[model samples]
Target: MTRPLLDVRDLRVTFHIRREGDLPWTQPRELHAVGGVDFSLAPGETLGVVGESGCGKSTLARALIGLVPAEGQAEWIDGKDLIGLSPRQMMKYRNDIQMVFQDPLASLNPRMTVGQIIAEPLTTHHPGLKRAEVKERVKAMMEKVGLLPNQINRYPHEFSGGQCQRIGIARALIVEPKLIICDEPVSALDVSIQAQVINLLIRLQRELGLALIFIAHDLSVVKHISDRVMVLYLGRVMEIASSDDLYAAPQHPYTQALLSAVPVPDPAHDMAASVVPLAGDLPSPLAPPSGCVFRTRCPRATERCAAEVPVLSGAGHQTACHFPGPLTEAEIAFARRTEAA
Candidate 1:
């Protein structure tokens, strides 16, 4: 087996938030944003992380690249433990790991020219690079990500939403990072634009031999780009498997419900689907239920589910649930038909 380029184990992120109607002396409440997430990525592999909003998908990504404080090991194959590094200490690994945010224009500095924005990482990480060298590399990267070399002098305001995203891609790739964390990179674009960006990332990953942690709520998009799929709920892993196995035979109730909700391409097929989509609001992370976080909303949930937290098990496929099995065909059909209220 090729050693994983990135191996994350029992990663957790927590935040202390002030109460809504705050009293100055009140102690902050603990918000368990990422309860415990574990996964690994080999060189050139893509791991798609899917979950509903506030399920800790974004928080997990942020924790991996050192954007937020994380507990547990994020061991890069080179032996660096990202969780222990300080801001200044982490600087050395910036080129090895990069991130592309969701909003294109919002991520860029409108005051800076495209060249300046893209070259910022290079300048910061490679301070010895001459101005001329930075410009040359930035222009080359622009060409790679479908941007124009001559447009380097243009500010972000001059570009469209899709173009601004291309600029973000160019910026992330400029340093030739080993891994790229794409946090809903396509969510802000048009469907057509989303396709273009997805394809661009696919090709770029192949060309650069880069690993990717693609985090998004869109199951179809995740299926398209990922070799493996991980399902998360309430800051914890629900199930994980190869994309084929995941879509065809999802074990966890949450994964099945999520896949059932993905729009079928054929109207006839959608009409034929009987699986009920999940219902009920995602429970607050601040005061999660005693055992499995998903029990409150799970149809098969029982007293055992409320008494014990299930552990993930398996070699090629893993699921964390008291039942530890896939939904029956009948249940899948019900899940397909039941839409969220």
Candidate 2:
């Protein structure tokens, strides 16, 4: 087996929430944002994480990069645990791990010029370089991401949504990091523009040999770029498998329901007509439903599913489902017969 370049084990993150009319001395309840998630990524591979909003997809990305406080083991490059590192210790790890946040406008500093923003990492990590070298490096990064070198002097608000995201990418890539945590990088852009940014990311990944943890709510977007895809619900992992296998024959009920909702391109077979609608709002992370978090929304859920949380098992494909089965030939035939009738 190819050894994973980055490995996350039982990663968990929680936030404290105060109860109503509670005294300041009272201990706040812990809201589990990420609960015992595990996955690994090899070099030059993209691991896509997909789920609905509030599913902790974004939180998992932030946790890996140490942007948010978290607990659990994160081993990268040299078997070092990132979660246990101090701020000073984490500073050394910064150049190896970078993040491109969801909103470029919000992520980028308004006062700083694009060149300044992109060069900030170098200044912090490689301050020995001369000012001239920094300017050259910043301009080169802009050009690499299909931006005009002349615009290196421009501010964040001066660029278009797509351009801003490109600048964000340039900044993330300027450090030449080993892995990038992209949290919905293009979800805020126009559909046409999303393709451009995704293409840019793919091209850069190929050229630079970078590993990526791409987090998004849209499975179609993830399907376009991911090598492996993992489905998340609430704060827990539901399934993890190769992109092709997961899409072709999803092992989990949640994964099937999500794929069923994807709009089919062929107008003759409208997916909306055949797709199953997911019911109920996603339960609050503060008080997630007992056992399987998805039991309330799953169609194949049973009493056992509600009584115990299924562990992720299997050799190649992993799923947290008590009753795991593919759509058998018999089931497919029956469905086709019903459609014919």
Candidate 3:
């Protein structure tokens, strides 16, 4: 087995918020953004994180990079625990881990030219390099990510959504990080552009042997770029399995519903037949249900689900649910009817 580059165990991120209430001083509520996510990534491997919005996908990414305060262990193979590191302390690992944000243009500074933006990381991490060296490396990275050297002087607004994303990719790669966290990097672009950026990342990953944590709500996109897929819901991991296994046979109710919602490409395919209907909206993380966080909306949820929290367990493919497997025909029918009513 290739040694894992990053091993994350029981990682959690919580936030305290105070909302207006009848009392003079309302007690702050704890919002569990990430309740305990565990996974590992080997060099050159890609881990796809899929869930609905607000399911802690971005939070988990931010936690790993130390953008948010996180608890539990995120041990880098090189003997450093990533959790609870100060910004100054994290500077040591900045070159090893990088992030590509969701909005490309927004993530880049409009005032800076493309060259300046891409070269910023190099300057920060390798300040001793000569000016000529920085410019040469920046131009090389620009070409690597499908950008023309002539466009280096152009501002972000001068480029298209996809091109801006290319610039972000160039910026992240210039540092030559071992792992890159892509938080929905292609979500804001057109379908064609999404494909282009995703393909670019795939090619870059292959060529550079970089590990990636691709977070996206698009299951089809995730399936295309990921070796393993992890399903999260209400700050908890619902299921984790190899990309082929998870899509072919998802065991958790939440995972089933998420995959069922993915649009089928075949026009003749029966969409309704494949869907595992889920009733009710996602519960508030501030007051997540007592046992299982997903029970409030899960069709297979029972007294056992509400009475006991399911620990993520299993050998290769893991699921955190009292009853894990494909939804039964009866259960599917009942869920569909319940949604209709």
**Where is the poorest 10-residue window by lDDT in model 1?**
332-341
Off by over 4 Å in 3: 20-26
- Candidate number achieving the greatest lDDT relative to the actual structure: 3
Indicate the residue-level lDDT of 239 in model 2: 96
Tens digits of per-residue lDDT, candidate 2, 216-276, equal 9888999999999999998899999999999999988778768878888887996645665
Expressed as tens digits, the lDDT of each residue in 174-195 for candidate 1 is 9999999999999999999999
TM-score of each: 0.95, 0.94, 0.97
Best first by TM-score, ranked: 3, 1, 2
- Candidate 3, residue 33: the lDDT equals 97
Return the lDDT, model 3, position 114.
99
In the range 103-210, model 3's lDDT, one tens digit per residue, is 999999999999999999999999999999999999999999999998888999999999999999999999999999999999999999999999999999999999
lDDT winner between candidates 2 and 3: 3
Query: What RMSD, rounded to one decimal, does every model reach?
Result: 2.1, 3.4, 1.4
* Candidate 3 vs. true structure, TM-score: 0.97
